[model samples]
Target chain A: MGIPVTIENPKPEAEAGLNDLVALVADGMARVNTTILSRTGSEVAMIPEVANHLIASGGKRLRPILTLACAQLCGYADAEGRDGDVKLAASVEFMHTATLLHDDVVDESDMRRGRVAARIKWGNEASVLVGDFLLGQAFRMMVEVGSLRALDILSAAATVIAEGEVMQLTNAKNLETDEAAYLAVIRGKTAELFAAACEVGPVLAGRGEAEQAAARAYGMGLGIAFQLIDDVLDYGGTSAELGKNVGDDFREGKITLPIVLAHRRGTAEERAFWQRTLQRGEIEDGDLETALAILRRHGALEETMARAEGYGAEARAALDAFPDGPVKAALLGAVEFCVARAH
Target chain B: MGIPVTIENPKPEAEAGLNDLVALVADGMARVNTTILSRTGSEVAMIPEVANHLIASGGKRLRPILTLACAQLCGYADAEGRDGDVKLAASVEFMHTATLLHDDVVDESDMRRGRVAARIKWGNEASVLVGDFLLGQAFRMMVEVGSLRALDILSAAATVIAEGEVMQLTNAKNLETDEAAYLAVIRGKTAELFAAACEVGPVLAGRGEAEQAAARAYGMGLGIAFQLIDDVLDYGGTSAELGKNVGDDFREGKITLPIVLAHRRGTAEERAFWQRTLQRGEIEDGDLETALAILRRHGALEETMARAEGYGAEARAALDAFPDGPVKAALLGAVEFCVARAH
Candidate 1:
């Protein structure tokens, strides 16, 4: 389905585990990073520059944090044998960083998260190549974990991620793109990594195939929900609320779900607004208001939120296979908050 | 020391070990290809379109060839450990294919080995992500080999190659590039995989540090020489000789050693031509002829060949440290051809 089905929101009390996951993500970032940065390059001149820029660029570190929470919930609660956990998290981060560098190059974008992108600051060539450097380094980190299963999971996720990126490229500026195709693209581009992160945790904990698969499913649903929310925020939230410029995607000729739904369900006049603003790449001041109005008139925004909520519900369902525990609760909370977060 | 001093040319002859190495590479390709294709993607619809284009446009498979050669000369001459040798060869091929995909994207070139470039066929997004897919697949293949040292070698080489590519991006059309800087670039961009290829052989063969290092030294020197001869071929040979246009580098404004030395050692009148054609990127019809003449007149071409000879000599010296064997002689012959091949 292009749009996700609607699901009831979970209890607010579920937020407890989500907060813990966030803090766990922060700790994982500091711990895995020291080793990762040191392993980057032995050469003195370029190593620090590369590491500093990479470290300074703050991210949610969502994948690593998920990994920690999954491992904890699966009953590997202590830091003992956490090397594999840390390394997998680092691997996810490396993949994330690499994609960022390459994404900026492909988009020819200069700015990301309020900082000049690596492609712009260091030059496109460096950004592209350094992205590659980190990808290889990530593999090196994972190999020491000594699990073929882990390698297979991460590698397959990577393939999906790249394929997702291509799917996005193909889908760009095409108003006819339905919600099904859009979700497929996101599955590859974003959800795959999340799935890999959570899956790797149970895998490292030496769980059975069923549990590993369950964790993986949980991650996949959560990652999709997270990205869906991100897309929704691009339209619904303000700059201060979402910490990004609103209406930026429509301006860049990108076709998010809100546009997809509104274009299909709106009146002829509403459809024309999308065609002019998106297909023609013309976004004037006050166009955001017009676009938001069309979305509201067609009930597309609510529909989009419903889709994300469905994924969040599916993500929570994946955790039902695991036993009752704080970690499981935390992971479940993460899914709810991921879709519900305005920012 | 910017340009390597010419080492004495030895009339190298073929050995059986080298022939076996060739067989090993060819066989490795045949065997691992099933996994490579399947791993790239499972969609039957997309397979013939995305993966086939690059795979069919075959270069010499030189990277893997280097790995087989490394294994043999490093004393893995016994056919007993064929899988290890083949896996390494396949791993190197994976890395090379990945780079080729990425390079085509960054350069935005249309022609590769007289066929439409992969990016041109699949589009930039497919090209980029497929490249990422191949890189991820490469790590998977390396994991299959089950050696941490092999993983380290390939991973380190991958990073260096990326860094080298970035360095080249930085140096594009900048005539200020010197011989040492040029050498460093080549080492990263071209020589790294070669060095790793050769080193892995000894490591796989269960050799000690000295032998592995010797194989590595040989591979690195031979790769540099191979690149030097390629640059020379770009200037002195025809399209048929080099597999594509002879002067494609000049057209794309790449300042290789031929131009690097000409820029440094040419007359004032000649300097203007270098500045305009290579540095200024205002190359025209007559510039190719004029640039060729300047290379000849200043003896830059001869000197460039002399550098190739020097690297070739070092490549041979690495072999002398090895005990007498058929594989050793074959490795020697390959290095000789690397520097002396007509193309």
Candidate 2:
């Protein structure tokens, strides 16, 4: 008679891994925060205005934290190669922020970080142009750091991210997007930055190629897990936690993992329902509830969470290259924290 | 009764300077063209579809040509530092093309390069993302050249260009925007890249700081002249030549040099006419003609061309460091060609 309420869904817990990583990298983070605020400042008022609207918004700054933590894990202390780490960390954050501004416009979402979106605040033209400004500043910082290897990694990541965005656009609202296709989208959009952020840390620390590879693998797995959980949470999380309205991905017809699983498991009639709501954009009032019912009936949410947990494990295994230490422990905990959000 | 056609505005002539530059750099230009096409070919179908829609549409490729000519003018022959020149030249062209894609989206243009605009053909989201791809590739090529100074200059130009775009946004449709403000906008939006494009060539050629400074000055002056001529042509040139709809600036409320002069010199009635049409968007069928008449009455077009020619002279003066040869003559002639577009 109503939408199925799955018992597999658990209450959202405090993100301990994120908190630990934040505290562990507090000093490096302070430097990064300063770099971000300073770089966003421009003689052109609109550049800073639109940039800070989102940058100043209180996201976890997790991507930069990953950069700092990964660098520390690789034994890059403040005296040795810490300056490069901090600079690269800030660069990663700027790149992330720039993508968010552009992504909001592309997705036509009106909210970001629980506030009115930059596109809504300054208009799409301002958002797009300011995003370019941030990206330009990101590259400037990368050049200042003067690490060709780091530059190569981050610049390639930028290209991959853009390509991923185009790939996502091509797959949007398509009922036929499969798990392989879904993984490809997240790998580009989310995981590549995560991988680049972690990989660059070891490269700057003068660590061996093996350490860099481990860092890249760890970050990529963590990024995939994090995004999978995000896709999961879009259906059920609170706006306070999400910083945007729930059901956003659904509203936008993003072909995320749960939808892919649900579509595969549902009946022919259920498939038609999804086709009408997602592909054709005939989202009725109770369509979200019905979609949830079908997803739960087929255990799609639990399966999606299980897949995220698998990725989180892979991420932890990648960190095993480092000897046991606070930094390593914190990174593993961070992986757990990413998957825990789905609970 | 009709729009005043100024006697100073002669019929469009053959672009001798451009033709000469192209011929002088023909070998390097061939390599650059190859790099551009190779880098732009993406696995994702939409990216190339949107990118090549603009890139292959017969742009003058003036920026890349400048990079080649500047390097050759500094005595960087193919046997010496020619490979880097070709890559960087391609990089400059890619950067220019990226900006064009974003510019069309920002301006909501429906035409570019005498064809339907990329935004119209693929939508804003596709255009913006593809532009990012080109920029990412541009940096990749810059990094491969292994010149930190070149990367620094180009990256800084990218940031300044974005700021200029925002400045232009602030000045749009505002009759109060003066000559100084207009110059600042163009300096950021246009001249910065021009300056960087020329400066990087000398920098890569192992040239001294003095030579680099000279190249920067040459590029800055040429870029200013080029942009001023573009502004003039926007009001009077054919769509075939301008590669955009004429009177676009007027319709969009852009305060270019011609409008700045006319606004400074116009009477109360004429000022009100500008305010009503440009500031308030109350354009009538014959308003473009009326606007042209006002421009002619103040000799704004002719005076704008004079300012462009002045900058062209400055550009030629900056080339004094280079020895007399085919490259030097071609660069000087290129300046003449840019200004000659007005005639």
Candidate 3:
């Protein structure tokens, strides 16, 4: 009592809806994390250093969690007490991490996940090669799981993701990019992996085509919603909350939904501002604030959030194929969490 | 007067030894080329543009030819007239092409196959992403072949290649890198894929582990010889013969065998030159000539060629397990061709 006892500040509550999904898959994710760490090891020291910088960073393991939850929903059971889902979950993470490495290099990004990007910390050469290493390791892990169908799904997803990235590159700073084109790009780059991650789970669980389709649809819907929110947060949220600099899309002149919507709806003068700052790469100091103000006035961020909610609702409905359970509830909660990130 | 059509310059006789192997695999190679063209097509036009720029360029296509030759040596015959070897051959080429793309970026190489590198013509971002697309497509084609064992072999080779690339990166411009380290780097980057390419052929042909081992050993030995010759040609051969500028390795300060040998065998003064030019990146005009003189003074290039001959002999001896036939003869000749390139 003599010592002025002070209690540590109460720990901030975990992100509301995502925490539920995270808690539900905590056991599976532990196994996945173990697999990820073990598989990323190489005699080449730089590989694990670069890969773990991103892998061990605190981004939500949302995609792998989807893989685990989908497998559980499909009633996956293995006699040897070794589920292929764990390896597959790790594989999913590797693919994601590999893409992130390449993306940072492509975008010349300085920060990622509230930390300096691997490409910036390491060199671009290291980032590119390490990304390739992780991708190779990902395929190796998939082969070990011995599921041809799963491999097909994931490999095809990878191809689509690459195609999407190139498409996005072509679309960057092009104000003429319409919603349909934007959707195609995001579906290729982002949604395809989510779809594959969810689809592989049911395939490994020995579930039939119907369940697989349901899982894929759910993942696809949720992934689109997730990306839409990401675009919104790039303009509407803070770096501390987003784990990336706010208005990074604007800085990079990346034409996302907000930019697409705003440009289409903007007056000639406002469009000129976008063209100068984004298209022409003549960004001035106050441009991000101007971009944000333009986005708010036009309600572009709100409309994007609305579209995300629509996709989230669809993701929720896709899970109706399975009986209501903790896994299913958690999956639905994850979708809500993705959409709610805008707020 | 019969229009004296000037007879086209008599086609230079194909390199004596490699021509035999190429002729043996010509029919299969046609199918493989078709598969490659069809597989690389994407709705994203830049992918095919960048990919075909390399694939359609006049490189020897030696690796895919090895896959086809090994399958024939294993007496692969598919009843439906659809040999998985064709697809596997294409997959092997895609992997090689993907590696070439990434390597060009990592090396900042300007010329490849006597043409501008795709990375320079397009951009590093496109090169990285398109290389990824090709890798993904390679795996997709492997999965279509429905051989999990083949997938395992190739995927493992890919991981090793990436690790080797990283190892090479670490070794670059570092004078302390020794011959053992150099060999390790090449084995990981070069021989592993060759080993896998040859190993998968017998696996697809339903051969036993012994035959697979023989094929793998042959490919491994041949691969080492091939890379040694490549390293030699970089210094000793002409730009037309080598299809890349001579002294590129020296300019890049790459720590290959010649540099390693010369540095190790040189006098204190010579070592200082190497340390200043390579280790410290203080290369000056005429540095390449000085490097060449040092290498020649130590007989480094000749010793490297001798080493290639030794490996080529081992590669040839590996064919003892197969009956004496055209395929065996062609394979042996191919090894000789690899070594003879040094001349």
Candidate with maximal TM-score? 2
lDDT at B94 for candidate 3?
Answer: 94
Q: What is the Cα root-mean-square deviation between model 1 and the actual structure? A: 5.3
Residue A143, candidate 1: C-alpha displacement in angstroms: 2.5
Decreasing lDDT order of the candidates: 2, 3, 1
Better of 1 and 3 by DockQ: 3
- Kindly indicate the candidate among 1 and 2 with the higher lDDT: 2
- Model 2 TM-score (B-chain only): 0.96
Q: List candidate 2 stretches off by more than 4 Å.
A: A1-14, A78-82, B1-14, B77-82
Restricted to chain B, the TM-score per model reads 0.88, 0.96, 0.95
Considering TM-score, where higher is better, how would the candidates rank from best to worst?
2, 3, 1
lDDT of 3 at A184: 95
Q: What are the per-residue Cα lDDT tens digits for candidate 2 across A1-343?
A: 1223433233334476677888999988999999899999998888888898898898888899999998888877657543788889999999999899889878988999889999898888898899999999999999988999999999999999999999999999998999998899899999999999999989877899999999999999999999999988787776666787667888898989999999998889999998998899889898888888788888888899899999999999998898998888889888888888667
Per-residue error (Å), model 3, residue A64: 0.8
TM-score per prediction, in order, is: 0.87, 0.97, 0.96
lDDT of 2 by residue, B203-258 (tens): 87789999999999999999999999999988887665567767888898899999
Error of model 3, residue A223, in angstroms: 0.4
Error of 2 at B294 (Å): 0.3
Query: Which candidate gets the maximum DockQ versus the true structure?
Result: 2
User: Comparing 1 and 3 by TM-score, which wins?
Assistant: 3
Residue B132 accuracy (lDDT) in model 2:
92
Query: For candidate 2 chain B, which ten residues in a row score worst on lDDT?
Result: B1-10
Whichever of 2 and 3 has more TM-score, that candidate is 2
